[model samples]
Every structure is written in structure tokens, then in C-alpha cells.
Target: MFSRFLVFLLFSCRSLAFEDTYVIGAGDTIQISVYGEKELSIDSLNINSSGKFEYPYLGELSALNKTPEQLKAEITQGLLGDYIISPKVRVSVVEFRNVYVNGEVKKPGGYEYQPGLTVDKAIALAGGFTDRASRSKVYIAQNGSDDNKNKVKLSEKVLPGDIIVIEQSFF
Candidate 1:
């Protein structure tokens, strides 16, 4: 039993290692830094509706479909190739847009996506399960994708826009 429990724990930790990299999206605020160039540390970069951002030196750059790291690399490459030499860039996400969590939770609303957040944690953040909430029957609707609407059971990690539904327990 001890060995089985240990195996389960290891598997759980490994499965939680999904990439949480921020993909530049509209309404997302990002912080971009250029190593050794204090003047280049720009904050509050909002991706436009066309998924682009404008910097004074870098001009307009695409932010959509690019991770924070990827965006940094692209900026560094662009700057180094055309203007600066050997640029070092770092990108960080200062704000997440939002994620919705509703149904059966005590407070049921939206919450920001933080590191190491699980289904149980999100539910707890919404004031926890109500007396009529069936914890065991918790369901997650990921991205509202109908093709991927299959239910997930015994899973902890829930993604953004995942609607957690707690069924009413029949007595």
C-alpha cells in the first residue's frame, strides 16, 4: 500500500507540469525587459485587437499565438539583427485576463489563474462547495469546446475558461 501511494504521488506531480506560459492575447498586460537596457523595460503592453503591440524602437510586433518566452526571443532577434547587438530580453506576465468558475460552489464566479491551481483549489476559492454540492461529481468544460466535451474524472489541474459543474447529490 505504501509503494502504491508513492507511485500515485509521483504521477500526480508529473502530470501537473503542463506548460503555463502566457500566450499574448488581447487585454493581456505584459512586462518586457532588455538586459542592461533600463530604458527598454516597458510595462503594460496591451495586445491590440489585431494581436499586435507597438514599441518605440521595435515598431509593431505580433503578440498573438506566441508565448512570453517566444515573444522575448523574437524581439531580441529583431533588435539584434536590425538595430542592437547581442540583445538579451526577458518577458513576464503581470496580469492574467480571467477564468470562469461557476455552479454549485458557495460563491461561483470568475477567478484569476495562479500557479499550481487545481480544481479543488478553484472551487475552494469560490467559497467552497455548498451543502447540496456533490464534490465527487465535479465536471469541467474546457474552453467550451464541444469536440472536447468529454468529462474528466480524478483530475486536479483545470485550465482557464474551464467551467466546473458540481452536480446535486441525490439523497
Candidate 2:
């Protein structure tokens, strides 16, 4: 019964953290299309590990934490003056970041990130916890230089590029 409640809470946090428009992050590939502009349409434009993309006209643009629509608006704004008038731009994610799960997990490796990913969902992707895994001692470690690691509930929302560490139980 308690485990079931945890699952419910996990999904709730997942939905809240990841809604319709997912925030773009580093290592994500985005496809951009500008209506009627052949030169502006780009495919498989990968955001570098530093969260930047070298786009046409706009040069290098930051792609960290901005929604696709927000990126589209920025691109359109950049193309206005000398290039296009009222550029109808669209940005779509070609691929998302990969999340890693290590220690005490069955698989213990990196997995592709989906829209609504939670700690439990990531653990499940990693083939669930091992026999010695501690259910209440899991943590989410930010893989970036920022390093915001902390103990987390199974219900905690896991972001792309996050590292879910399932510590081992003593007993």
C-alpha cells in the first residue's frame, strides 16, 4: 500500500515537472524550420554539452532551459531586420538528454530521457533496484558543474542529465 502511494506521487511530480512544453537542455538535438526560408530550415542541430547551438543568422544561441516556442521567438526576432519579414519559425526537439542511474540498481547505466521522468521511473528503466538497494536512501545528483546533490524521495522528478544514485542498504 505504501509502495503504491509512492508510485502515485512519483507520477504526480513527473506531470508537474514536465508538462506540454519541455525545457530544452544540453545534449539535446533540436530541429528548427522557418516557413518559406530554405536557408533557415535546420535538422539535427545538436545543442553542445555547454548548452549552445550555432544557428544561421543568429550565430551561436543559448539553448539551455528555454522552451521550443521561446527559441522559435528568439530565432524569428533575429531574422527580422535584414533577412526575413515575419518569419514563421518552429522549433522541435529531435532528441533529449540521457539520464544515468548508478549504484545498487539492476542495470546501473544511462538511459534515454522521456518527458515526464521521475526517480522511480528512471530506476525502473535501469531494471529496478538491486537486492541490497535502499528504498528510502535514493538521491538525485546533478551531473553538471553546479553539483546540487541531495537525498530524494521516489516521487522526486528527475530531470534530463540527472544522476539517480540508489544507495545500498546495510541490512
| Best lDDT among the predictions, by candidate number | 2
Span of ten consecutive residues with least summed lDDT in model 1: 15-24
Q: Model 2 Cα displacement at 79 (Å)?
A: 1.0
**What TM-score does candidate 2 get on C-alpha atoms?**
0.80
The pairs that clash in candidate 1 are none
- RMSD of candidate 1 to the truth, in angstroms, is 5.9
lDDT of 2 by residue, 1-171 (tens): 999999999988875555346888778888989889888899778887688767877788887889887888889889997898678988888788899999999898989888767999999999999999999898888764336878999988877888888889999
- Tell me the spans in candidate 1 whose CA falls farther than 4 Å from its real position: 1-22, 144-147
Model 2 regions lying over 4 Å from their true place: 1-22, 143-146
How far residue 4's Cα lies from its native spot in candidate 1, in Å, is 28
Give the distance in Å from residue 46's predicted Cα in candidate 2 to where it truly belongs: 1.0
Q: Pick the candidate with the highest TM-score.
A: 2
TM-score, prediction 1 = 0.75
Q: Estimate every model's Cα lDDT from 0 to 1.
A: 0.71, 0.84
Give candidates' CA RMSD values in order.
5.9, 6.6
TM-score of each: 0.75, 0.80
Displacement of residue 108 (Cα, Å) in model 1 is 1.1
